[model samples]
Target: MTWQTGLSGFLAGLLISIVTAPVGVSGAVFLLPVQLSVLHVPNPAVTPTNLLFNVVAGPGALARYRRNGQLTGPLARLLITGTVPGVVLGAIIRVFAIPGPQVFRLVAAAVLLPLGLWLCARALRPAAGDRPPLTRRTILGLGLATGTVGGVYGIGGGSILGPILAGRGTPMTHIAPAALASTFLTSIVGAATYAVLALTTDGDIAPHWILGLLCGIGGLIGGYLGARLQPRLPEKALRLLLGSLATALAALYLFQGLNPSGGN
Candidate 1:
């Protein structure tokens, strides 16, 4: 890659890491478009490459979360059990049914639109810090839905899981660590699944390892710093920011879906 492009990738990774890492995401949401548009590498490979980035970047954040005693193995297990199969289903759907960005974005936007509105509305209400814990059924459903979307979109379902739970007024103190652990494990499974597919199938999909690694390196540092900052950050302020960001991203993708001529 050119120096200019390399710089862009690193900076993008850093920025996304700071924005999302604090909330337990691995920066894949922002990186997907960069891969699709900037690198002009649009295919099934995009998702896994982002997953690869997660693999490289996740450990640093996970370490921080674990050190802080935020991560729980049981929670990770619960999330993964539901997410793994769901992601496999999503991968299959991407391969067979919704390969095009236009259709996929439309579907994604439709789902995110409601969630975004709910997040916004929730942001306006009084904070519910002592909300009831999520039921097993609820966790299962979240994992399935999140895994499927993560599989199709690339990255872990934490982007969906994090904000949705937060909107429900789950404490970020708990949500942050759990989401990070969940995303870390989810990315591992997703990456392995994609690697297997690459081996069995023709040369249709494979990660751009070099690029993914560079992004991951940047994300590692950013993620560490974000995690350190998260506890100090005000809960209400963070939720409002996330709610606004989610709605805006949904709207952008929805607009892009309408204007199919716009590449990536």
Candidate 2:
């Protein structure tokens, strides 16, 4: 890659980290599109590359949550336990059940559209005073489902899980931190699964060593900044921005599905 490409990736990573920090997303929604559209990365490689970014970027945010005592240990453990298995399965599916790029785009649209709308609705709704206690079963179930999606899409999966937890009355304070921790753990699993698949199926599918290093450098800086600034942002405005961006990305993927000739 040229210096220009490196600079662009670095800046993009920084900006995404800043925007998504408040919302508890790792910013794969933003990064994936940029990788495809601007970097001209191929579809098959995009998920893995994004996963690489997540792997590099997730730990610092998780560490921040841990330091602040925001993360719920039981909830995080349950989420990781369920999601790890699902991530492995999803990676297998990515290799053997490899859908056409158009089909994958369509599926991505389906998953992200509803998630985006839900975020928007939650933002508009009034917050209740009391939140229900987090449970093992529910967290595990949600983790399993979201992990599969994240594994396939190469995102943190918190993009889906975060809103659900909030809607279910998890406090934003706890939800954001726990979700970030969960995303970090699950991302490690997903990245490993993808790495295994990439090695067996297509050695070139994910150039892990190079991409991982670059993404890590960017993610580390961004994650640290994002975690530091999380408390100051207005929740409603943050949700609106995140939801809007997710919706837009879903629409862009949907359009790409429809117009294969135009290219992503």
lDDT of each residue in 1-264, candidate 2, tens digit only: 777777777778777877776667767767887887786667577777777777777776767766777775565666677777777676667666765788778878877898788888878878766567558787788788888888788775766787887777776776776666667777777777777777677544663356455765687678778777888878888888788888888998999889998665
Span of ten consecutive residues with least summed lDDT in model 2: 203-212
Cα-lDDT of candidate 2: 0.74
User: TM-score of every model?
Assistant: 0.89, 0.91
lDDT against the true structure, each candidate = 0.74, 0.74
Candidate 1 per-residue C-alpha lDDT over 1-264 given as tens digits, one digit per residue, 9 for 90 to 100: 677766677777777787677776558876876777787555767778888888887777777877888886566677777777877777666666776778767765765666566656766887556567778789889889988888777767766677667665566777777777777777777787877777877644677777878888888887887888887876556556656766777787788889998646
Model 1, CA-based lDDT: 0.74
Model 2 bad stretches (over 4 Å): 128-135
Clashes of each: 0, 0
* Backbone clash total, candidate 2: 0
